[model samples]
Target: MAPARKEKPIHSLFAGATAGAIEAFITYPTEFVKTRSQFGGKKEGPITIIRDTLRTKGVAGLYSGCMALVVGNSLKAGVRFVTYDSLKHKLADKEGKVTPARSLIAGLGAGMMEAIFAVTPSETIKTKLIDDSKRPNPQYRGLIHGTASIVRREGISGIYRGLFPVMMRQGANSAVRFTTYATLKQFVQGTMRPGQQLPTAVTFGIGGIAGLVTVYTTMPLDVIKTRMQSLEARSQYRNSFHCAYRIFTEEGILRFWTGTTPRLARLVMSGGIVFTIYEAMIKAIGGREDEQ
Candidate 1:
């Protein structure tokens, strides 16, 4: 009967952070496979990568750089949701409705911020550690060691190896994902009765669908970003554009979607898990603000 109070940025931050950590922990092996496939130097399918990894390095190798991702992704998600929510609030009309285009802009802004502050460094470290783990003798011991080594050798830029591509990828990724999710969730919520809340299953499905769309739409950028951040790829490509050019010219066009299988798998689950947990966390942490 009462009006729903405004959404808090702090709640968004905490919910998004918790959601990201849980999603990363659960879906990381798929991520490992996707990154290895995208590395492309020794290109292999999901099955082959898993088999070889298990054989050579055993189970733990599948999670070689997980800690880096967990930490980075948690921070990234927190920043992303907070930024997106804040921007959406700013862009909304008198009644707080944001158009699809505005939603896209907000998500793009969020993605760019997270990419600059969190994703590039995190991804660079994770990519390097994975590369090192596959070597004859791995150089970096763990997340701390790998990061310290990178800082020591290349200074700050080392950790931001693929900033441009990462920026583009994350921006496009979040734009597509958030816009799609917001539109779909809004539509779904519209169908509900007054005083009703969205079902968790519906939220999960909507988020998964959004992620699926984003994967196909942004696959090439994802592949390029991974390659650019690679430890072995230092001398290979001059820049992100050059890396993309070579992958297209030398490896053929389809090469850009190298890790689609695992990435697709991961993102579906990840998107669903992230939004579901995020919603749950919001409800738990900030109390329900259900629509009436």
Candidate 2:
């Protein structure tokens, strides 16, 4: 295919939304398992997690808060890419080349914006649904009821229980992700002829690699965020720092990486799928970026 035409900011947003929905639907089961595993101390591996979840809640259990997650992710993705692109435009040099620092800054900003606006509240409900699934009797039937229940019990602030950790996790996540992605994408394009489109497989591979790097670098924060959010009350760890301290002292430092396997699998697949779909959708929508 020929190089795509230039794109506007709105194109990035739309492409991100489309990509988010597609990736979330496909990888949600892994996400559910990852969250469960993050609680740590259960000898159950990913396979057992899947088996138990299936046995108890059925296949639908694997998708408990899917719609809420999907919608939230859709909005978050849009905001993330849009903010990144806008920041990139401002930060790029005269030749329009973005340094690693600038790219990371843009990604951090994008992640923070998305986390504050969409991720915190969305994940609050999503985690509640997932946590509830293990209960003998699930309290919230679905997304709507779950949201209402949280508000009723905890008030508006309830939905933002893990806001600080979420911001930190997401900030680090996108910063590493976009920086790696941009660097790899540049290398990939450098190897090809001018105006030649990257193959779909290559795009996915690069995205997968970026996702892996992002996950490992930010795994500790991610674990803390999950622990903070998963609890219905503040009884367990107190705050993010205390959570980290307790997990370190009691569970050992390794507990910070409790969910690495499922998370790695989910994120790698999600990154590849999301990036591939995002690029394809952007191209289809007549939104294009200059060959870097």
Candidate 3:
């Protein structure tokens, strides 16, 4: 078998942005519901949450913060896939095969960079917008104003309220996701005929499984991140550790899995869509390093 080669970083970045935007557009409502369910102590079923949101805030509520999310996702996924591809390419052995360990390292690095640069601020604004929907007097008017408000009130740090948990979550999320998807594809396509592409169904299935693994593995941190980002001025929990401790002691450990329903749905769909499009884009761009 011939070794795979790296594609241009610009290609990877553009591919990531396109894939992320597509996924965000199609599945953003699920994400909205996920954020709503993640906040608040009581567990509300998906139906109840949806009905409540629709009844109180109207259909538009389902798409609240979607614009911000789209922009954020574009940047986040762009940076993530680009970083992963560059790192994996650099780390590949002489045979041009990325070992599982190397793949994992690349994924971790990508996740960390994306979380720090894109996810934290985007998520803070997105979550705040969604959480504010039910308020009698909403604090934020829109994306630009909301961002300005956060900066003005809490300084630039306000936008990064959940940086630690987000980093932990994204690091684990990308590491597990990329490693699992790549490993599974490699195993499934053990020795493909030259120029043979993995079937779309197979890619989607593998991606879904990868998403499930990522969500379950990082559920606790995800919950904590939601809480931290969703906070307004209330310092309910001191830090990530304190937040976890408080959630555990007050809301029970199971609360750490809040919004699993919408999250699972969103992720499963997102993983499949994003991976499938990204792979297709890479193929279209004439890149052979398809594993990661």
Model 2 agreement with the true structure over 114-207: per-residue lDDT tens digits: 9999999998888878888788988888999999998998899889989999999999999999999988998888799986899999999999
Residue 239 of model 2 has an lDDT of 85
Compute each candidate's TM-score over C-alphas.
0.96, 0.94, 0.95
Tens digit per residue, CA lDDT, model 3, 115-136 = 9999999999998888887687
Against the true structure, what is every candidate's RMSD? Answer: 2.0, 2.5, 2.2
Model 1 RMSD to the real structure? 2.0
lDDT to native, each model: 0.90, 0.86, 0.87
Considering lDDT, which of the candidate structures 2 and 3 is the better prediction for this target? 3
Alpha-carbon runs more than 4 Å astray in model 1: 1-5, 287-292
Point out the higher-scoring one by lDDT: 1 or 2. Answer: 1
- Candidate 2 — which pairs collide? none
Q: Which regions of candidate 3 deviate over 4 angstroms?
A: 287-292
Q: lDDT at 271 for candidate 1?
A: 88
Residue 152, candidate 2: alpha-carbon lDDT: 94
TM-score of model 3 (CA atoms): 0.95
Worst 10 residues of 1 by lDDT: 283-292
